[model samples]
Each structure stands twice: as C-alpha cells, then as structure tokens.
Target: MLKTLYKGFILSYLLITISCTTNQNSSDLIQAIDNRQTDKALRIIDQLDNLNEQDSLGLSPMHWAAKRALPQITKALIKKGCNLNITDVHGYTPLNYAIKADNAEIINLMLKNQAVVYKNGLSNLSDGPFVDWTEKGLYAYYLKHDSISSKSFLLGKFINQNTRYFKGWNGDTTTYTITDNKIPAWEFKTQEPIFVLGDIHGQYDRMVKNLQAHGVIDKHLKWSWGKGHLVFVGDIFDRGNKVTEALWLIYKLEQEADKTGGKVHMSFGNHELMVLNKDNRYIANDYKNLCNNLGLEYNTLFHSNSVLGEWLRSKNSMTKINDILFVHGGISQKQIDSGMSTQEINELVRQYLISGSSPKNQDKLNQILKSFGPFWYRGYFMDRSQYKKITEQELISILEALKVSRVVVGHTENDELSALYNGKVIDVNIPLAEDSIPNQALLIKYGKFFRLTEDGNKTLLN
Candidate 1:
C-alpha cells in the first residue's frame, strides 16, 4: 500500500511539473476552454497575443468558448477585440456556434456587438429579428416588448402559369417558378458515368462548390452533367444550418436533370426520418429557433403542403445503378434473409415518412426504422454487441440475395472513403461538414471506381 501510494505521488508530481512547464498558446487556451478549465482558459486568453489564431480544424478560442457555452470566456474574447465574425474551416462563425448551443445571452451578446449573422446562406439570427421561409412565404419575426411577433411583409403567390412572385407591402417584387416534383427511378442500367455523394448534412456551399468543381453543375448552378447520373445516398438534412438551402438545391437539380437525359436520385436517410418523426435531437438550433419564432413544429415546415416536404416524401430509401446498390446505411443479414425486396423496403419506408408519427413499439415499423433497418444499420462498419458482427460468408449471402456486386453506404463515418468486406462494401461518409479535408465523392466511370476530389481529379480505387 505504501509503495503504490508513493508511485501515485510521483506520477501526480510529474503531471504537475509538465503542466507548469508547458508553453501557453491559443491552441492551449482553446483546449483549456474545451476542458472547462475556466480560470486557466481566461488567464491564457489574457496572456495570448492572438485570440483569432485558429488550430488545425479552424477553431480558435472564440469558437471553442461559444460552442461550449462559456459566456464569461465569450465576453472576455469579445473584450479582447477578437473577430466575432471569423469563420472556421467549415464556414461556421463564432455566432453560429453560439446559436447551435442555444445560449440566448451569448447570442444576444454577439448580435449586440455587430457580429454578422446569416453568412453564406446560413441563418444565425436567433431570439431576435430574423427572416426565414415559412409555409406561406418569406416572413420576418422579431421580439417585441418581451413578446414574439411577426408580419408577412413579403407574401409569395402564383402570379401566372409560369411564374410565382413575391410581393411585399411596399410592392417590392421578385419572381421565380416552381419545378414539378417527380419521383425518380429506383433502378438504372446506365453506361454513363455515375457520381455518388454521401450525406451532405446541410452544408449547402460546400455541396455546391464540390458539384460545380466536378462539372456536375455549371456556373449558374444548373445541371450540366447531361446523360450522367448523380445519386445523393440519403441525409440532406440537419446540422450545418443550411438544410433549407441544400434541400432546395436538390429539388432544383432533380427537375433540371429530368429536363435532359440525366437523373438525380435522393434517398432519404435516418435524419430525414427523425425530423418527420419529431426527433429533433440532432437538429440545429437555428432551425429550432425558426420553428419557435414561427410558432410551428419543425416537422410542419416539411409537411405535405410545403414544396420541399412534398418532394421529400417521394424520395427512395435505396436505389440500384447497375450491379451497385446505394443505401444510407448497410443492410443487415437478417434484413436480407427476410426476403424483403428493395422496392418493398423503399415502399414501406416511404409509408412511414408519409405517416409522420412515432414508430416506437411497433414491430412492422421497427423493422424499417430501427437499427436493423436500411436507414439506421451500421453492422458493416462496427459490431453492436447485442447483435453479432456479420461474418464474410453472411455478407456474401446477403449480396448474392440482392444480386448486387457491392453495397455503398454513408451513415458510418470514416477518415476517407473506404472499401471493406473484401471490396464488397464501400463507405462514403467522410464527415465533410465537420472536418477540413478534401471534398470527395465516389465516381464510377464505365465499371471502374475512382475517388473523385473537388478539383475534378479522380484517383482510381481497386
């Protein structure tokens, strides 16, 4: 006992010595804030020469403090004249972090100090004057004398057969046309190049830039990849504050692609199911605040009446292009063994989406919406102890049953796009929205697979 105690004392003394001798830096300050060492972080903040200096992932002290909801550290950074509007590598400002945390005091503090909200098509204005697209049209909501109030100054209406215009009370006019939403084909045998994008998670600008760079969309952001197919394998919602913009872009692209010989497939993921089922745990605060300001539920924004909502309901949960099967999550051995066809899976999931209710405690609903479902399964990537990991032979039997060469999925994140299961499964979820890595997509050109980067460069994958 004495020997063990003496060893513990030496280890503690070494730790203290290391801590005392460590050099102070902005990165250290950010770490301190993340560790919740409030007093130490503050002292480091005061001693640091540059508060805006970012670490590897483009996070500074301001970003960390705001995200962690440390108001005192936030105030200290503001007092130090830190750039309030400084965006991280992922194009998120400190105010965006504050808004995500849902800290009203920090949000108000940033707004009062002239921090720019709504940068790059993302809404950061919460608990104050803000504008968002409602079911009717673009409306403005503001806090008035401790009570919330709103007025529809810009009322959008269908003015003509080919045009819809937004007319303000002051007669300010803007016009656009809505596209006819059509459900895409489930299976394709195209010889043309196929591009597969993983979960976007509402990073509109990043998605657009990646598409534009790859010549999928032109400078005007219209479909340019004629005769080629683009598949978004589920998850175009939640996180990153640009869900609205991302959804609209996909909507627009779907119609444009139909105009030519091209096709765009939108497969609904678990996040889509969550929102429709009133699961807002992973939802961004900006959206929550928008719903609060409008006095409506979050799911109501995407109800049948709304254009995006109606369009989303028509999406598939899985699609097949040639011998490749694209799904949001992996298919379990049991799911495949049940002899459920891809069409049946899509149909059942679509029905659940349309119902827009809790799927809890129901055996039929649980099969499609629960962990073993196509939208939630991750057995290919990791093993859940309750459910044994699928063996190589089980995977082979599953693929043979589906008649697919390989299955592509996006729910499980990886450091890079990876091929596993003896090249039978591919994981495209690289966590693009959270990391400062190269934007990549899986490109299949004439039966050859390649990792296509944002610069239109393709690296062949075996």
Candidate 2:
C-alpha cells in the first residue's frame, strides 16, 4: 500500500511538472499577444516549436491569434499546418473567436485556412442568438449600410426577395405576408407525370446538365417540362460548394414552372434540418469561407424571413403524389403510429422545428426526431451497418398505415439508384454533386416507375 501510494504521488508530481513546463513555454507567447507585441510572439512561437500545442488553458497560439483577429498570425499558423479545427476548452474554434471579435476579415481568413464551422464554431450564433440576429440585427445592418435598395444583395446575401418596404396598416390592423409564392399544395392527388430527383448536394453544374439532358429545363434553367411536375426528395445543401448557385436555379425554375402550369416541390432532408438549426458539420470549407467573407451567417441564408427558407419551412418532409409517397430518409412504423393524419404530422413537425420543443405530444416528436422520422428514418435501405433495420413487413405496414402505394426516398448514399422491398422502397440519392454520376431521376407516369437518364430516355423499372 505504501509503495502504491508513492507511485501514485510520483505520477501526479510528474504530470504537474510537465504541465507547468508547458504553461511556462506558452506564457511568453500569450504575454506577447496580450501586450500586442506581434514580433515577439512570433519569435516565441518559433522558439517553442509547438505551433499547434495547447497551453494550460487548452488554447494554442493559433487560438490567441484568432481571438485577437490577427489575420497575419492566423495565416502564419495555418502555413505551419496547425489543427485549424481544434476546439478550445470552451468548445470555441478559431473561427468562433474571430467571429466573437466581429472581425469578418479574420473570419474569412480562418475559413480559407480550413477552420471548422460545425455548430456555432464560426459565428457564436445559434438558438436565441440566431433568432435575434435574423429578426432585428440583420435588416438593421442593411439599413445602416444603406443597402436596402440592392435587390441582388438582399436576395443573394440576405436570402430575401423584396423590392420595397411598406409599414402601412389596413384600417389600423397590422398584417404580415408571404410574397409571390404561388406553388400548389404539398400533396397532390393528380395523375399527372412526375419527375423525382434525389439530393443535389450543391452540384450546380451537374444539376443543370441533368435537367438539360432530360429536357426538364432549358439551357437557361427555365422550366421546359410543361405540365409535368418535378420533385426534389430532400438534401439540397452541404458536401459541395455550389449551393447558392443551385438554390438560385431552383428559385428561378419554381417561378417558371408556375407560369407554365408545372410545379416544383423540394422536400426537407436531415441535412437541411441540421443546417437550418445551426449544425454545419457536413458543410464544405469553401462554403464556410464564402459565407464568412460575405458577412453572412449560414443561419441568415435559411431563416424564416428568407424566400427559399420560408418555402422550405412550409414544405412537408413526406408528400404523396397520386399513389406514390416521397420522402428524404425512409419511414418506419413508429413514425406512422405517431400521429393520426398526414396534416397532423406535418403540423407537429413544423411546430417542433420553429419552437425546438413539442407543445403537446413530446413523445411522438422525440421519436420522429430520432430513428423513425420522415427526415431521419432509414431502416428500409440501411440494413447491414446499422443496429436496426425496419423489416419488409414493417415497411409495408408503414405504407399501408399512410395509405401510400410506394415510398421513394433520398438520404442514404448509394452507388446506384436502388429499388428495395420489391419496389416498395426506392433509394435515389446518387449524389450527383459529389460522385459526378450520370444524372438520373425516377419518373412516375400514370403510376408506372421508370429510371430517367440524362439521354432523355426512360428505362422501365421491373
């Protein structure tokens, strides 16, 4: 017992000594940074030969540079190959420190240097802060900078499409409005032709190419499908850099589709929900740099006030067209049992999304957010790697409960578009944005399924 106690004491003493030595080495660098002696700091950092080493406070020199908004030092640390995504003791990244300093330039530099943007690591904005900024501060900044008149700036940067502002009241009653959104209902009982595309994942060029090849859109991205309805089965964000370009194209097409009697519907995917809620782990670094440089939070790009953002929020994750149901991730029996009606489920989901808590049925909402929601349920296709896979009988049960013939979904990454459960469940997220696969979509015409390729040809699905 005495020997064991001595050993423990020696180990503790050694750890303390090592920690003290590290702190001593880091102290000079921190002092130089606090004293604003950049040259001395840089010299001390070099002498220490620990560009990425954390101090007693778990803050590296890179963190200090970022907190100070010193772009030059940040760049130097990045060139020295520091761990740009390293989180400090407070769960703050270098990007977060820069954003806290309100140094957009340094934030941009860190983003360019491949700093992390997951959660609130970039903007120090999420939840209450996110809601507050999007509501009051952003437009105030626009007014302060005299940029309310630039329509392109407003739409592209602020995610809004507005030309004028009017505070007039109608007979002393205040009113709010959604402008010029004229899409049809979420669920359509129409027997009309439907073209269903999977996740685009920021692949603008590939999306354009596929749409052109299928004659769905003209070279200018105008709708050419006439009365044929087109649906995107969730996940239009993250993993690639051309998200803004793709979103603008979709926005333009929605208008053209409406004018031509066609329609466009974008369902919500898990990734979409994650980003809207300020979780950006799957986002690309280029997107991070772009948003930071433009002084745009990822939050602002998809708030309730934004055009596409509002439209997305108003959309249902699951929609049934004719007899075929479309969703992002596949559904399960638990989700089917959660609510009595489709409208009920949709309302519950949208409500939970806005408020972050379920008002009435907390149990149902929690299940939906977990393994069996319309946006997250993946049991139909994810059978091998996952602990749980919804059985074939369960899939049929869910479909029967929902009164749908088949469930088409796009969340699981597949090498090829797959039709599982004997044609009851179809997985179509080929990730054209990431894999550069030949553009493919599922076409349902008069209740028959076919794979529509880029050659404008349709192969019958057996």
Model 1 residue 193 distance off true place after TM-score fit, in angstroms? 0.5
Per-residue lDDT tens digits for candidate 1, residues 1-462, read 999999999999998875564444556787899998999988887776568888888887888998999999999999999998787888777877887888877875675565543323333343212233444453322321111222111112223333433232222222233555666669999999988889999887888888988889998888999989998988887876777667767776877888898999889888998887777778777766555532345675566645667678888889999999999988897787667789987877776677743645255566777788898898887778647777878899889999999999999888688788777888888687765788888988988888888867778776
Candidate 2 deviation (Cα RMSD): 16.7
* Model 2: lDDT to the true structure: 0.68
Model 2 spans > 4 angstroms off: 1-98, 102-178, 181-184, 292-296, 358-361, 384-387, 434-436
TM-score of each: 0.65, 0.63
Report clash pairs, candidate 1: none
**lDDT, residue 172, candidate 2:** 19
Top candidate when judged by lDDT against the true structure:
1
lDDT of 2 by residue, 281-337 (tens): 877775565455344577555676655566667767668787788888877766666
